[model samples]
Target: MGASIPPPPPVITRSSDMDPHTLEQLRAVKEMLTAQEEEAQGLRDLNRDLRERLEDCETKIKKLNEQNDEYAEKEKVLSHRVAEKVRNNKQMSVVMEEYERTIS
Candidate 1:
């Protein structure tokens, strides 16, 4: 949140002695109000920009997570294929040994 605005200056009465300084005081107060308003607006703009960046980051994370899941599934399929190949090789080795025994 931005800085809180100060309470407005006390209302000036039309007494003769205080009359001279009233206009000066009014001008000073007006300038202060303007400055505060500008600061608050700048903070609002910064907040909005940060929110947009966070949303972009979240979207990117979602895409990467989905890609990772696909890779994991592919790895499972390849592992099964390798296991099957190893079993087939063992069976062939046993058969070759039996054939040599018969020939000898």
Candidate 2:
């Protein structure tokens, strides 16, 4: 195999050697990165707030659901009582009708 070529000497360049356009591009990139970081932070804050609100909403929903369940149970009990009263009333009416017939 042929001998490997010797590595070239390191070239030392000053920061001033960078073109103005390249420097400007670097500055723009930095600014963009900073803006993105700020935006990300704001989004994180908003997300936290939304999460808190969501939790509050969920808690309220749970409480309401529990209340609804209690109301439903009460309604069932009331309906049963109402049905019993209707049956009693029907029975009383039948007795009254028979009594009226006998009297007439």
Candidate 3:
């Protein structure tokens, strides 16, 4: 934890002050606290990893959107070119028809 839990109240200075059962209880409490600390650390690590992945995904999505925009622009340009070609072909056909009529 950010602020360590003080270290478990130090070992009993003398055996006379506390009974065996109390000492056992203290040891069990210490073990439980240690387990909780380890679990908390694991959760923190997992959170950090997930944040990194999310950032990576956001970057990829940005790049894909840029590519899609580029494709749309290219499609627009190509469509305009096709329309121009159709108009030009029609004008050519009209000119050829006039020439044929005059010759006949």
lDDT of each: 0.89, 0.95, 0.94
Give per-residue lDDT, candidate 1, residue 44. Answer: 93
**Number of clashing pairs per prediction, in order:** 0, 0, 0
- How high is the lDDT of residue 49 in model 3? 100
Off by over 4 Å in 3: 1-16, 97-104
TM per prediction: 0.63, 0.80, 0.69
C-alpha lDDT (0 to 100) for residue 56 of candidate 3:
100
For candidate 2, write residues 54-88 as lDDT tens digits. Answer: 99999999999999999999999999999999999
Candidate 2 wrongly placed segments (more than 4 Å): 1-18
Better of 1 and 2 by TM-score: 2
Please give the ranking of all candidate structures by TM-score, highest first, separated by commas: 2, 3, 1
